[model samples]
Target: MTRSAPVPAPAVREMDIDGEVTLFHEPTQTALVLNETAGDVWRLVDGERTADDIVRLLASSYGAGPDDVRGGVEAALAQLAAHHVVDLPSPG
Candidate 1:
């Protein structure tokens, strides 16, 4: 079963500064800070790319192994989901 790609929440306002991202979730009134890598992953969340795609993207860009990239991306995505900065849909 393939999982749906994560989609960034529409109500988020973001600021990119010095390779980090600051996201403000309007509805929850929460502010989140993501590091350079997480910010890169966030930029790719257009509801079109799956978690595997995110891992590959980061791995290729950083010359890192897929194993190394996957965990960080997943962790960042989890954090984003927890904070309501992004939406993670379950597979049916």
Candidate 2:
């Protein structure tokens, strides 16, 4: 079984273009722009919370049903992981 590694706090810097926002990370040159809901979810990744916990939080906070938030969070995390902005949790 794969073990989940502790998620680390992202080193983030943001820029506002007119009314739009984009987050930039120097290490991976990954630029992430969050829509309103995704932005809310993004704020919860404070290094202390696991990905599973994040999904749970999002479900409650956003009034989203469990399945939707779980799917969305997992997809977002996968994307972030691909960009090296966040680490993925292993099955263990």
Every candidate's lDDT = 0.89, 0.68
lDDT of 1 by residue, 1-92 (tens): 65589999999999876667899999988889888778888988889999899899889999999998898899989989999999986867
Which lDDT tens digits does candidate 2 get at residues 1-92?
Answer: 55354353367676776655567878767788866655655666666677778888889887887788887887776666665666666664
Output the TM-score of candidate 1: 0.88
Among all windows of 10 consecutive residues in model 1, the one with the lowest summed lDDT is 13-22
State, as a TM-score between 0 and 1, how close model 2 is to the true structure.
0.69
Kindly give the number of clashing pairs for every candidate.
0, 1
Best by lDDT: 1
